[model samples]
Target: MFSYCADPSVLDGWWWFSCFLTSATHLDFYRAFGAVIALLLVTAPAALAMGMAGAMMLRSQIRPLSMLGRFYVNIVRGVPDIVFFLFVPIALGQGIEYLLHLVNCPDWDQPVRQGNDFLVCRDAKMPPVDAPAWVRNLYAFAMAILAFALVFGAFVANTLHGAMQAVPHAQIETAESYGMTRKQAFRRIVLPQMWLVALPGLSNIWQILIKATPLLFLLGIQDVVYWARELGAQKTSLYSYPHPDWRMWYFSILLVFYLLLTWASERGFSWLTRRLSHGQATAEGERLRRATA
Candidate 1:
């Protein structure tokens, strides 16, 4: 960024170092860190909502809904996560395109599958061929988010399902005796209590989700891992800011980044657990009560 950086080859020591660190590529790398954080912020809540819905479906009194929920949890959890990471985006994207093609290209008579090619009318293209790079990136990012939500949602579903069941039957029966309907009892009583049980599992899932952020690279999102590898590679004499193989250093930074994330996540969850446990009957809750007294 410095004026002296105009000729990086002639520069030395701190001047060269500062220039290299502030290079355009390095700036993009720095921004990728924020991208990772953004993905986590967006995906976590979306996944939770999907999970809660799946869990509720599993617990539905309607037999069909309960069966659908069980099928969802079983099918998703049964498959490897990496497989889902690879499959969901393509599947979801094609599914969306297929629907759009049907709606937009109703008159096109050609088969969508010609040999290995999946064809759709020009109007059926997701962002259109003339769309900007950022639009394409955004579409890919949206797909990645959906994939993450579906996979992690299953884990959340299983966790919440168990947590819902862990709530004492007597409490629900007591609520029922007071003339509260099943839905009312669940909303007012069972739901709040279940968090105490679900939090630990959800915390573990959160950690997994953190680790899984790197997989965004596989989804073509140009995430932190992508930037790290790209920026850390050895540069030739032809390049303005040439450097040796600094990948080890770049990866080390990523390692520290994730460590800090997990550490911060642990602290946050601990505080949440304490808050959720307040005035409850569990050991932690009782301890909190006594401490307050």
Candidate 2:
């Protein structure tokens, strides 16, 4: 923020633009980029771990565990993603509050949900109403992260399950012939091959996850999209900094940001694929070997 921004009325041309870009709201917009990145950084691994667990469950000998895995994976397949995103945070929030209410407000007279409102005791409110701004933001962000994880985890589960299945029986048998136990062979033989096979699907999931970051706006976090819409709208003379509608400009920057993000992600995945393929006996490995030779 600049001193020139104090009198937004007299500001004009490039000087006005400099102060405009440096304004408080624009600073928030800049920081929102970090929020999106943080969400991705946290959500990606969480989803992968959940997916791995779900995949193993899908393969479990125990009927109930397998059934649970089936439900986990199929829920994403059955429900539209946007619908799932909308539902998860609200459901999880209510569920948490409900548990809290039971513990903290058992003696309270009114129903927890009265008509259209969810009325939890002050102590039971998630983060409590009086908590600082950052705490509330962090809680909402955490909820969004979990919501994204649940949806993407299901897709990743299916991908991993198929990849594990695609590991040849011959490899497992050979590992057993070498006096390895089933678990040992699974770790030493099956797991490595599974990742090699799974890379393509996982790569796709990462791309989709990137595109899905915009949905953070819907989850109540002031994400990049939310900031863009707010800052890009026409500012009337009544506002400190008056400007014409610049949403197109704002969105164009977002477009560039996403394009670059996707480009970088694809390059990273391609490199990882090559790294995974280098020593393997797969066709891609052979191709790499021939190219190197």
TM-score for each model? 0.97, 0.95
Residue 236, model 1, lDDT: 81
RMSD of 1: 1.1
The parts of candidate 1 lying over 4 Å away from their true place are none
Q: With candidate 2 superimposed using the best TM-score fit, by how many Å does residue 128's alpha carbon deviate from the native? A: 1.3
lDDT of each: 0.93, 0.92
How many clashes (backbone atoms < 3 Å, residues ≥3 apart in a chain or on different chains) does model 2 have? 0
Write one digit per residue (lDDT tens) for candidate 1, span 156-233. 999999999999999999999999998999999899889999999999999999999999999988888898989888
Clashes of each: 0, 0
Model 1 residue 68 distance off true place after TM-score fit, in angstroms: 0.7
What does candidate 2's lDDT look like per residue over 45-161, in tens digits? 999999999999999999999999999899787978999999999999999998999999889999877899999898899989899999998999899999999999999999999
